[model samples]
Every structure is written in structure tokens, then in C-alpha cells.
Target: MNKENLFDTEDILSEGGVRDLFEEVEVGEGEKIVKQGDAGTDLFIVDSGQCVVIDDKGAGRIIDSLDRGDVFGEMAFLGGELRSATVRSNTPCKLLKLSREPFVRFLRKQAVPGTKFLIFLERFMVERLRKADSLRVLISGDQDLSGKRGLQQLRADIRARNTKPLLSADDPILSEICHWIYARNDQVLFREGERTTDLFIIRKGEVVVVDEGAGGFLLGTFGANDAVGEKCFLDGKPRSDTAKVRGNAEILMFTRDTLVELLERDSSMAIGLSLGLGSLLARRLSMANRTLRLLTYEELREKAEVSRLLSEMRKSLRIKTLH
Candidate 1:
């Protein structure tokens, strides 16, 4: 693969803010840049060579071949997760390595508000994970093997899973919830500052959480099986960010009045929802903090300057910590 063909050099260099964060590294053929299970602290962009991704099955597959302008190793950096695959140079190559801190800073500096910024970061992280999963399936030559048997097995696995439910499928109160909505690709689910109207659950497909980008950077994308709009519903506050469909999606929704009626009747459902909301909020906050910490100083300055509220918030946090 031609490096130049893989990435738009001028566009990525301009928008990715990678020029300063990247350092040139030369690798011999078969040299490994990332090892599975290692703690990931940096992401790489191919500058002049192709790389192969190796899975635990000892299968070496070319998921993506890069010459330049392509990025990898993003999932671990965004999610604080361990490297899920090993990336090795396929030939003598020149690569650009961007440390996590600087990349996070770069994302932060993008003209997005802090809260929405965090939501975007979460979506971005999830998108990378999905990409990696897709690559795994492709490399295993299973891309065309979507068999009914496999799907049935997957369904069985899901049924057998012991994970706690965010909301019970059979909850009677669900029937009374109004304001139900279905979203199609690129449809706006809601935007920052929209009145709190309903709580949503991912019945199917994916919804991306994005921030209102003032003029800076795209925060990220999120997908199916995720619930959003709970914060606004719970707090009676305006929406903090934007939610949009990643693809065709179905959302189970409960209007504010329905929630109130539920609370007035089956208080336990409200309590469970509150607990679930807290868990989701905590996870979002942690991801945001990780992203903020990973950002470079320049990125921080850019974000701080974009919004006065963000600037003051950053200043207050810094001061509070100092005292």
C-alpha cells in the first residue's frame, strides 16, 4: 500500500495536529510496534510502510496497509484498555508515533465544549473498538461467513450472559413511556441545550454521542447497545451534548412525564434507573478525564480559549487542586 494513498497528507497534518506530537521511527521488516496485552500509551500513524495485525490465534492478517495518513492503536489510548492485537511492520518502514498525552491534548483543543467533548471522546473510543472487532473478523476470513448457525450461537451467548440489565426487558412501566423515537443514519437525536424530554435506551443499532464542535475537532462516535439522554431527564437540565444515529437505530424512550408517573407508582424502577444513570455518568466522566489528561498543552490551550466557560472551569479545577 502506498503511504500517501492511505492518508491525505496535507489534510491530516492540518487537522490531526500531529506534526509536533509525532516522532519518526524506523523499523525493520517484522518489527513489532505494539504487543498484545501491553498497556497502550501511544498511537501510530503510518508514514512510509505497511503493517500486519496479529491475533492470539497466531494468525497474521493485513487488516489495513498504510503508507501514510492512517492511524492505529487508538482503542487502547482512548479506553485505557490493553492492546488487543500486535502490530508489526510488514517491511522496512518509517512511522510517526504520537504519545497519548499529546494526542489527547489535541482532541481537547478541538473547538468542542467540555461536556460534549467528553461524550465525543467516549464515542470515538467505542468506534475504534468496533473497528478492531471488524478487522479481527475480516482477517480471520470470516467476513463472508455470517451464517445462521453463528448468529444463533451469538444469540445463545447473549442469553446466557450474566450481565446486569440497565433496564429490565419485561418492566411493565416501559409500556407507558411515550416520546418513543427511531433514528436513521445522520438523524439528529438531540442537541446540546435542547429541553430535557425523555430517557432513551438502545433497543438496536448504534447512536453516536457528539459534542457541539465550535470550530475545532470531531470528538468521536458511539454505537449500539448504549443509552443516552438520561442525564437531562434525571436532572431536568438541558441536554449537554448531541446524540445522532450512527446507522439505522431504534431507541426505547420514556418521556419526562412518564418517568414521573413511574416514580410516583413503581418507585423501584426510578431507583434502578437512577443507579444505572449514575454508573453511566461515572464511566463518561472517567473517560473524559483520561482524554483531558492525555491531551497536549497546546490542545488544552486551544480548548480553553474556545469557550469562556471551559476556560473558567479549567482554571477553577486547577486552582482547587492546588489549594
Candidate 2:
């Protein structure tokens, strides 16, 4: 049974914000903390002592041990699903509980700690999803294994087409982060002002990025190894451009949440991705600067100034390779 605390105690404890939000409780040995099939909306962190997580669906198997700093009940709170496992104390325990409402309130009030907590929380769910999916594949046997291998190959093909840093075909986690999409000719992937969470990599064929304003202008046509929807995705805003398939196309999608998880796991990969995005942004800025040539001298000077700022911006992103 794979179970580990996804959050660091130091990170959580750094601000009294989250700690202050939690209500403390003391429990005697053999006390049930969370029951299977219960409508659980709160999360628990063990302050001291031990607990056992039992998978009630399968002969009540003991899945993992919980100790001080260990957290449980998060999956239910996050997914708004029934508790799949029952957690009970093995020894007298001290615990801190956080309900969903208060946690949300804290997040709205305390941005820094809230951001850190959410990052840890997202990573936790990603890990759990990975393990659960792996277990499902394993139990399904050779047929599923063969299917997964084909999917892995597809993931690799899309990864090769990504504008970002090269991800190894052997990186099993990348398969989880990237999703494949197929579109027919003239398909509209997304429209301007639509709220979307995905950044797209064109694996085959082409995509035209269109900006709507002044009768809708085409920003550029992107082919294999090019990414789109990044500006809005990274800025946490609605899509500013529409993506239309120029022909039948294959794409790999990276949702913002999963990309954050990937970056958390691999700093080198994060640096590589940042460099790639920086390069792309620089090219766009240069192109935008060139478009100013049609304007008057003052307008062109403004564009030139903006281009200079962009150049400085790219230089500011110092890349450091990890050992």
C-alpha cells in the first residue's frame, strides 16, 4: 500500500493561517475517525499517535498507517465523493480537522499559504490517481498492458511534437499528463473569451490561432511541435484567441493543473519548459514589433520600446541546470 503525506509539515506550519483554521480533537485508541461510505466533507491531519486506513470494499484490508503529520479524508473532500476507506486510531491520537467551507474561506483570505496548500493538495490527488490507475491496469492483465503500451507510444509521439522541453518516452508520468485529441479539417478547438484550462501541442497537421477584434485577424498558423492557448492558460484568464484546425489534426493537451504537478515533480523539466515558452513569447513579441512598421513613427517607437522590454524580460529568466 503506497501512502505518504503529500504535504510538508513545515510548509503547512509556516503560516498559522491553515493551522488556525483547523479544529483539534483528541481520540482514544480504537476510535474511528472516518467511516467508509460516509458523507465526508472535512480533512484530517494527525498531530500525534497512529491510525490504520482500512479498505472496506475488499475484505477490510489495511491499506496504510497514519501517524503524526499524516493526512487523510482529503480525497473525499476534494472529489466530493464517499469515503472509500475507513480510518481508525490504533493508539490515543491528537488530530486537526479542516472542513471544506473554512478551507475555502482561508484560501480567499490568505493567498500565499492557500496557494502552497492547493499545490500540495493537487499533487496529492495526482499521486493517488496515478497509483489507482496503475493498480487497475495491473489487475486487468496482459490485454490492458498491450493497450497501455500503444497509448504510451501515442503519448511519446505527441511529446515529440510539443514545443516545450523534450520529455523522455520512458517517462511514464508524461503519459498521465498528456491527453490525445483528433480533429477533422476546419474544426474549432477553442473560441476566444472561452474559459479553457488546456494548452495544446499540435502533433500533426496545422492549427490557426485567431484573435477577434477589428473583424477577427489570424495571429499565426502553428504546425507540428508548436503549442497554443498558453498565454491565457498561464495567466489564469479566459482564452484570448480561437484555435481552428487547418486540416485533420492530432493534438496533445496539457491541462494547467497537471502541468503544475509535472513541474512540482521535475525542476529540470520545469526549467526546460520555461525556456521553451520564453523563446516562443520572444518570437511573438518580435513579430508584433514588426507589425508596427505599418504605423506612424510614434506608434512604431512604442512597439520598439515594447520589444526592448520583452528582450529584457527574456534575459531576466536565468536558466540554471540541475545537478
Q: Say which candidate scores most in lDDT.
A: 2
Q: What tens-digit string does per-residue lDDT give for candidate 2 at 1-323?
A: 00122223235555546668889999999999999879867888888888988768648877578777777776555545466568999999998788977776665555445545654554444333223322222233322234333434433443344454333434677677677789888888888789875778676788987656424555567887677776654544576568899879888777766555765666445434443553344334323323322222333224544444333322211001100
How do the predictions measure up, each by TM-score?
A: 0.42, 0.46
Off by over 4 Å in 2: 1-10, 143-323
Give the per-residue lDDT of model 1 (tens digit) for 164-211: 556674666676654556778988878877985566777677676654
Q: Name the lDDT value of residue 62 in candidate 2.
A: 78
What lDDT is reached at residue 133 by model 2?
26
Give every collision pair in model 2. none
